[model samples]
Target: MKSLAELAEIRERMKSKVVLREGGNEIRVVVGMATCGIAAGARPVLNAFVEGVNRESLTDKVTVTQTGCIGICQYEPVVEVFQAGKEKVTYVEMTAEKAEKVLQEHIKGGRVVEEYTITHAKKA
Candidate 1:
C-alpha cells in the first residue's frame, strides 16, 4: 500500500512515459502484442524498449506503443519503427537484449540495426 504522496510521486514519474506513447513524438516504435506475439515473448521486448527509452531520456523523441498482429506471426515479437520522413523498418525475432540494442543504435544513433531487421533476417 502506498501513501497518497507516494502515489503522486509515482504518477509523476509515469506521466512522461504515458505522454510519450499518446502523442508528440517523431519516432514511433510499434511492437506486435497479439496472442502470437505474446507467445513468442513480445512482452519482455516491449518492456525493454519502454525502459530503454526512459533510461536514455528519449521519451521526447521516441514513442513506444503496441499493436495487434503485424501479419508476421512467423516473425512474432516483431517491432516496427516509424519516422515521419523515413520508411518504416520492421524488425523480427525480437528479444529484450535485441530491443535494447535497437533503442541504442536504431532509435538513438540514427542508424538501423540491419541484422535484426526483416530485410536482413530474410537473407540469413
Candidate 2:
C-alpha cells in the first residue's frame, strides 16, 4: 500500500494466482453461494470441497470457486464439477459429506457420482 508500483505488482500476482492458465487438464468445482444457496448451507459444501481437494493433495489438479445463483432454487446448495474437455456434472442438494464423496470418487477416480448429479435426479 506504499506506492502505485507496489500495488500493481500485488495485483499482478493475485491475477496470476486466480487465473490458473497452465496445466492442460484441470478440475473446476463451482459452488453456488447466492442468498438462497447460503441459506441452504452452501458455505459448508464449498468449504468441504476445498478441504477435500487439499486433503487429497489435488491442489494442482482442482480449483474450487464460488458463484452466484445457479437458477435452481430448489437445489440451493449446488455444486458443479467441470473437467477439461468433458461435460460438466451438476450435483444438487450438496452437503459436506456429498462434496467429500465427489472429491474422492469423481475428482480423483474420474467417476461421476450418478446419485448426486442433477441429471440422474431428473432435474437437468
Candidate 3:
C-alpha cells in the first residue's frame, strides 16, 4: 500500500499481457496437462503455445489454457484446437518443435498439419 500511482503503473504494464476470453473471435488452444500428459511432455508444448502467441502478436485471438486428462493415454501430450464454427482438431504425441509448427501453420495460416494430427499414423 504505497501509493495509488504505483498500483496504476503496475496495471498499465500488465495490460498488454492480458487476453480476455469473454467474447470476440477467440481460438481456444487447450493442452492436456494431466499426469500422463506431463510425463509425455506437455509442459514444453504449453510453453511453446504461450510464447509463440505472444511473439506473433496473436494473443488477442488465441487463448492458451491447460486441461486435465483428455482420456487418451496413448495420446498423452494431446493438444486440442477449438475455433468457432469449426471442428476441433486434436494433435497427438506432440513435441516442442511440433508445437511451433502448429502455432505457425495451423494457428497462423489456418491450415492444419495433417502429419502431426491424431489421424496421422506413425511409422513403425
Candidate 4:
C-alpha cells in the first residue's frame, strides 16, 4: 500500500503464489454453491468437508472449494471430487452427514461412494 510499483510487485507475488499452489498434487473437493445448491443446504455440506479435512489433518492433501450451477439443479448441493491424475467423481444431493461419509470413505480411503453418484439414479 505504498507506490504503484509496490502494488504491482505485490500483485505479481500473489499471482505467483496462486499458480504455484494450483500446480500441487492436492485433491480438490468442489461444492456447488448456486442458489439451488444453497437452498438445498450446500453450506453445511461444505462446512462438513472442511471440518473433516481439518480433523484428519489433511489440509495439505486436500482443498475445499465452491462452484456455481453445476448444470443439475435437481442435484443441488452437489460435491465433485478431483484428484490429480484421476477422473472426477460427482456426488449429488449432498448433506452434512453424507459429506462426512464421503470424506472418510472416498477422500481418506480412496473409494468412491457409488450409491451417491448421479450415475446410479434411475432415468424416468
Candidate number of the best TM-score:
1
lDDT (tens digit, per residue) of candidate 4 on 26-119: 7999999999999999999999999999899887689999999978998888999999789999999899999999999999999999888888
Off by over 4 Å in 4: 1-25
Clashing residue pairs in all predictions, respectively, total: 0, 0, 0, 0
Across 1-124, the per-residue lDDT of candidate 3 in tens digits comes to: 6999999999998776554533564699999999999999999999999999989988779989999997898987999999988999999999999999999899999999899888784442
> Clashing residue pairs in candidate 1, if any?
none
Better of 2 and 4 by lDDT: 4
Candidate-wise lDDT, in order: 0.92, 0.88, 0.89, 0.89
Error of 2 at 4 (Å): 23
* Candidate 3 clashing pairs, residues 3+ apart or interchain: none
Which consecutive 10 residues in model 3 have the weakest lDDT in total? 16-25
Superposing every Cα of model 3 onto the true structure, what RMSD results?
3.8
lDDT of 1 by residue, 1-124 (tens): 7589998999999887775566578999999999999999999999999999989988888889999996889988899999999999999999999998999898999999999999997888
Q: Where does the lowest 10-residue lDDT sum fall in candidate 2?
A: 16-25
Better model by TM-score, 1 or 4? 1
Compute each candidate's TM-score over C-alphas.
0.87, 0.79, 0.83, 0.79
Candidate 3 TM-score to native: 0.83
